[model samples]
Target chain A: MKTENFYISDFCTLRNGKVSKNGEQVYSNLESENIKDFAKGIYKFLELKYPKFHKMDELCKLGFLATEILFQDMEKIDENTALVLSNKASSLDTDRKHQDSINNREDFYPSPAVFVYTLPNIIMGEISIKNKLKSENAFFVSKRFDAEFMTKYSEILLETEKATNVICGWVDLDNDKYDVFLAFLSKKGEKELTKKELNNLYNQ
Target chain B: MAELKEELKEKIIEQLSLEDVEVSEIGDDDPLFGDGLGLDSIDALELIVLLEKDYGIKLKDPKEGKAIFESIKVMADYISKHRTK
Candidate 1:
């Protein structure tokens, strides 16, 4: 399989209850009670534009949205499309809250609420359900982020023809802060994706 | 009684993070659950805690809270009857 073309369809970010464009805050007043709500708010925003979104948890919302953006023009993205996601926190916010519940004498038991969000891959599950994608899915935790890892895994998916298109990004949610960046890589030789391109797109 | 209802409304707003809703928007008889303020099960739990902490009413079952917390008027009435504090 010869891997060649890929492009980004659409991307969104919510910071401090506001959508930022090129580092400028736009569309403020996002109502989110927690980190999950922040993720939900973004999902709700995109769901309006993309009708295919199936309501689910935050991580999946991120994945489904990324997949939607990747395959918006296509009729359907089959199980062959690989999903590669990276995050630093890896549901640490949920873990910390669950730990707090366990430590607290009044609520010493872990609520299923907190435990459900503990896994790093729940986002992928959300994406799979929404897009009906059963292709390869990977979740990695890094001290910062390894671009090489993303490129390498994406290459494997393409080379194997397991996926004609690859959806990859970094999504991290900690406390009140959340950030996400995703891109679609295809084998059609549309645009050459370089380290510089990824850095430039994400760094901003 | 009116004061308690107002306070309850404020507490509901604060607890639920209904940032967009104003006190004026919540009428005394307005439904707190479905279409009125659009609160969900989580908000109901928070309200239960509010009832216990503020009004000295402990509902042994969450199901019992459904009828008692139908609206601000209903909650205030239930609290008046059951409040130990």
Candidate 2:
């Protein structure tokens, strides 16, 4: 019988060349002025040398970078961590890249590297692999970022014991536009999560 | 034949996400799978696509990927004989 159940323990948001933790700026005014370059700068800032990062589509890179920054200071990462991430664009950004590869008959190349990231869940897989988390995970495509939905779903997973810990948020990107809001959730924390609180945090 | 092998090596690195690897590192006669290049099944599929998209060689069976993707030397020879465009 666990008391003081379900709290969104720590949260991180990355947008427009900045990373914030607990609604406070951690890294800001990134040297890169554009989104494409900003993503690379974040990867470099994190000092990640994983070759896979260069191969990933922009959406996966954004999510992967956010997760890396969120968990940078976190000491103990649980194995049963379930990732519940949602996005408005789904995998359209990479889908467009895949389409471009085959659209031109003269320059046709249905590249497997580009084709591999056609699914949104691939971002979760990338993060899971990097974090060494082999557990429950889900990816959703919505018209808009739904903070309430994320909180509710994460609570269910934690309450049902499907996952001991959860990393949930919005990792949406299309072209140069992007927004990432990731939160770490568990039953053993002080900040009890509510819909409004999640909304406030996500908006930050 | 030497030119073709060198071309295949460059294409393999470009097509696949072998970012850290350079064209000079991959040997023409070296094994493409397991120890030599460490290419897995997914890389094999990418090579299959490379054969069709660049050389117009369609491999309908999955088993065909093994013999064709053995080495850059083998791939160059196959492409030289079969390339349509």
TM-score of each: 0.60, 0.87
lDDT of 2 at A119: 97
Weakest lDDT window of 10 consecutive positions for candidate 1 chain A:
A48-57
Evaluated on chain B only, candidate 2 has a TM-score of 0.92
Candidate 2 per-residue lDDT over residues A1-204, each given as its tens digit: 333368888889988778888878877755776666787777877888887777788888889988888788889899899999998989988899899988988887787777889999999999988889988999998987787888888888888889999999999888778889998898766678777878888887
Question: Where is model 1 more than 4 Å wrong at Cα?
Answer: A2-4, A10-84, A94-102, A106-140, A148-167, A173-179, A184-190, A193-200
The superposed Cα distance between candidate 1 and the true structure at residue A100, in angstroms, equals: 4.3
TM-score of 2: 0.87
Compute the interface RMSD for candidate 2: 1.9
Q: Across residues A71-187, which tens digit of lDDT does each residue of candidate 1 receive?
A: 546676666667788889888866887688689676444444346667888888767766777788899998765667777777777777788777777877776566777776765
On a 0 to 100 scale, what is the lDDT of residue B9 in model 2? Answer: 83
Cα error, residue A13 of model 1, in Å, equals: 6.5
